[model samples]
Target: MSSLTLGFIPLTDCAALVAAEAKGFFAGEGLDVTLSREASWATIRDKVTVGALDAAHMLAPMALAATAGAGGPVAPMIAPLALAVNGAGVTLSNRLSQALPAGAESLQEIAAGLAAFIGQRRAAGEPPLTFAVVFTYSMHNYALRYWLAEAGVDLDRDVRLVVTPPPRMVEQLRTGQVDGVCVGAPWNTVATRGGLGRVALRTSQFWPGGPDKVLGARAEFADDDRLAPLLRALVRAQAWCDVADNRDELAVLLAQPEYVGAAAEAIRPALGEELIFHREGACVPRLEHAQWFLTQMRRWKQVDGDLDAQALIASVYRPALALEALGTTGLGAPVLGNPAPLFDGTTFDAG
Candidate 1:
């Protein structure tokens, strides 16, 4: 049996990692796995980059950033499997409700309200509204940027974008330090349930079927002989996570002190329908899906012309390896990964 350690942040999407350990999937694969809980995404990325952790539950885009040397230290990483998608929601301060237009049903309406607020603040000479995302290269940041930009809110001038850890998102809202936050799962639920904020938009509303979290590791670690067994264990746990009947039980498991540490009820916000581990073409990491994150990184000026997005995506997303791993376990089918659709009607093809 082999021994290894994995790191994860306290987000519900870490379920795949947690499930593998709790359900003995790793042990079944003849591996001894130790799960370490980290304080932030940076810690997870750094630990994995430095070989302190064998692998990690990582943000899909952050893995791209780490590989491309876009926003942080340059470390070659690979994501063999996507863990979850569309598990994030945007929460706004209650004070924004007063600013919303009557009958604000769709995201467009809510965004219009924010536009008006931005205009009013500009006219009053007040400082721009501040919003926070978990990291610079995160789905949360892009989702929030797209939402605000769609409504003509200048991302730089009309609003200030900051990075805040997911665990502290609700507290930031309660303290009025940030006007809104785009955070994952339980954090958004915690804010709304505790009356600290209101959910203005679910990420799925504008961008469904997008990659959220991924199984991340340095290129060297990802290529190790142990990767096949790790993938086998994680794939089984992912299938377990995809089943609707397992959600209730999984929520309780994730809320353990060693995992997410939030209440089961809080974590439930992202279970079942909103979160995906293996199903919906999530089991295989796709270069096409990775393309979207890199595109966003370029759109935000995080990376420049020197970076080849396609080459970077290929270096980091090993779908062939994932498929081979699944084959070793007799998982039957091979998947190219479902090409994700964009809310803006942009066509996406794996080719």
Candidate 2:
């Protein structure tokens, strides 16, 4: 088989793809994969659109947005599998964290505090609060919007949302260019550890089983019979990474220069249980997170109207393929159904 080249941003969620290639998971499945570290999500999306990349670790909503041509540079993209879920957080600057009312806990409280902060800042002639997120189509943006809206804060008028890369988020917060940021793991932990910020809310709190990252490929590439095995190899890699026993090893692997490029110590806090949240305390992983991400796509109009979004998401995540590759048919129940209240305010029976 020809070696497949995949693109991924240097983030903890990119680990499965990187590990699949490094640990020979792909080779064991009769595939050779080259993992390329992309500089930005836009670059990764463009490369996949133009076929420069066979596959990539993509933002779930971004993949759907590309397919639907909703925004950004239009391209045909599809995810044949989900990679990770609910590993993102909304981090507030240290000042913001300290200003919350006593016993203010949970996203609702943080949102309330943020509203008050914005008011106080404005009353004192300070500038409006500026916030950052990785991408406009990302769940981080949607989740942040949802959380803020729930608190009766108008996202469009009450605050400013800017596009800042994940790597730069902590620095941006530290420098005070932004008051808060919603981004994936390690960055949030990094900000907290550096005493620059505190996690106001974890993505898991808003949408418990939210989709985080996915294995995306060009539509034509996905349709190609030759590439099916490569997709299968990725599914196997996800399963391998999903095992609790492998978490420690995966954390070490992600710390390598070629992967996340962060210190192992920095990456460790995010890989284990006791997921830190400024509002709610740490919690365990929930299997339904991917479904929550799909719901976010629907909420933000990222999915094409022509497709049944839920079904499309289900098809993309091929647990059966992973099971086949792992030769283990019994690995716990399959993740199914809407994990939280649907963004559309509708409900469906999983059966």
Q: Give the alpha-carbon lDDT of every model.
A: 0.84, 0.69
Whole-model lDDT, model 1: 0.84
The prediction achieving the highest lDDT against the true structure is 1
RMSD of each: 2.2, 5.3
In model 2, which runs have C-alpha deviations exceeding 4 angstroms? Answer: 274-338, 341-351
TM-score of each: 0.95, 0.83
- Show the lowest summed lDDT stretch of 10 residues, model 1: 342-351
For model 1, residues 72-130, the per-residue Cα lDDT tens digits are 76999999877777788899898876678878978888898899989999999999989
- C-alpha lDDT (0 to 100) for residue 292 of candidate 1: 75
